[model samples]
Target: MPTKDHYAAITTTLLVWGLSGALFGALFVGLYQVSWSLGLPGWQTLLVATMIAAMTTSAFYSAMPVALVGTMAGVLASISYLIAFGLKAELITIAGVAGVAGVAAGSLYAWMVTRGSRPLAEILNGLIAGLLAGGLLVLAFALTGWQVNMFVLAAVAVACVGTLFQLSDGWLVDRVAHWLPAMLSAPVVAGVIAAVVGASIWFIGGTTTALLDDRMTAALEEILSSIPSGLLGGFVGGALSGLLLEFLGFRLEAGR
Candidate 1:
């Protein structure tokens, strides 16, 4: 018994969530790279990069009111990276954790914000969905020891950037104003967010690379190679979860 408006809202929410997840993943990648590249100590790079990224991303989507969702997603994404580091003690592990966390957090936040009528139910469902998404990415990473290279990293970054620009200039603004459908706007927003996130991750990786001694650089590279796949996992997981929520009949509003 859904109306056209209802369907439209659901679709838009999914797109936005997915796009946001991807962008956030990219930011983590960039942060990791920057941290390593800068020769800063452990965690210091991550802390600075995350704060900057959170502020930057939040400011860009200030009008969406779901800005907090993005910020929360960022925090969760960072936590994932930290968890990965603790769990596997590998750079790739960190990447995997970041991706899973971003997808889960972003999807859950979007669903909760959009499903205003049943906030509690929506949140419960979203949490389940997020957990599943994160779990899946971790599984995928385990199954595939993906490697990251400069060329591969650059490709992901460019793709995310293209998507981000599309969101900033395209339907995202209109979607926020109720002037356009979320499906159209969400993807665009997700793309931009992904790019920004990727940049942050790259930053972290680069920083890590610089700090290590020559003897450790090769080992670091091997570990960092898993980042690209981790990012992809996070982006896809988030998008799928958001889409799943929409298919199940959730509605989203302009701001939470």
Candidate 2:
């Protein structure tokens, strides 16, 4: 059903976002490395990066300052909890923090964007949704008993639930959400998109390498040295997956 323009928009958007996301991906990963080097907790770095992704992507897609602030608050709240209850941090604690933060971020975005008659209802809905999401994720984890870090799981739940809670009424939003639950439901779509973009980036890189094999290969190597291929690949991967949230109708335009 999409026209040529739609496909064109998709291409352009992917290029720009993919590049930008590469920058973020590389930078965040670098920060994590730095954190590890500095002996900071891995959970700290992971949670912070995850929160940043959630906040930045929400702002980029939703065009809502409120969303950014709310997400920031959510991030801060999680950190504050960790700081306050360092040794006593439990799974419920992480889940509760994620749920509360998600609700705050999602409700604020929904409220500011919708201008609907039921802002409170939406926020409350988000609250319930966040709590339910956190609880469900926790229960799922308990059943399967993932060996991964709890903070990462918390972050995933918050990100997914936050976006879900921010759903506003729109034809496109509803339509897309049926297939993609605000970026969470359709992992395969997001993964496939990211993989394709990454492949494209690598292909371009390979072509450039071939073009300069004889003359400017040194220059190419220098450039690659400066711009890490891994970072670039990360950027493409993030861009591919992050923007799908928008396409999935997570970011609702005003008045449908």
Candidate 3:
């Protein structure tokens, strides 16, 4: 029952976000190279870029109107990174990989939102999934003997929560009467959650490192820090693009 306008909005939003994500992904690759060349921790640079992408995408997605908003946001944000930082063939490969992942993640999230499920169920599912993934990553680091950085982990955690919100907002908005207020408060909640998760990961990683001389911990930490940021960025970017499309009188639910 969606209208023509809605379809248009969704299409435009997806187009914009996809392009942006590819650009960002390239940029991130470049940044990673630069950081590595400069003797900076590759993970730290990646973490910063991811944070930027997440915040930008989240802000845009929350206020925007469109289906597949989260996916678009991810794509666009990734594109931005590519444009700014990408270089060699390997970097290009990474960008492509990220793009595919973004598409898959975005599609799944969009489907969930459109289905209008219970907010609590969605949130719980997201959180559980994230935690399981994160924990596994931590364990992987322990096996490899790596070091963990708290700041990067914190940023990643925040980004993850933000991404979850972006994908589940429709259900959340309808379930909670004070949805707008909650949306407005999301960043703060995300920040706190990120801090807690980050701290917990850091503590666990550190303890494991002390008990076991695994240097792979650092690599795990880096991965954890970056993934959330990338996801967050995509969410925010898609949201913004969707909003812009909506403002132009395009709806993603027209003719229903």
Q: State the lDDT of candidate 2 residue by residue for 125-201, as single tens digits.
A: 43344445445655665688676432243334444444454543233334443443332212222222222222223
**Model 2 ranges off by over 4 Å:** 53-230, 242-256
Residue 175 lDDT in candidate 2: 44
TM-score list, all predictions: 0.34, 0.34, 0.30
Q: Which candidate is the best by lDDT?
A: 1
The 10-residue segment with the lowest total lDDT in model 2: 185-194
RMSD of 3: 16.7
TM-score of 3: 0.30
lDDT of 3 at 17: 56
Question: Which portions of model 1 show Cα errors greater than 4 Å?
Answer: 63-227, 240-251
TM-score of 2: 0.34
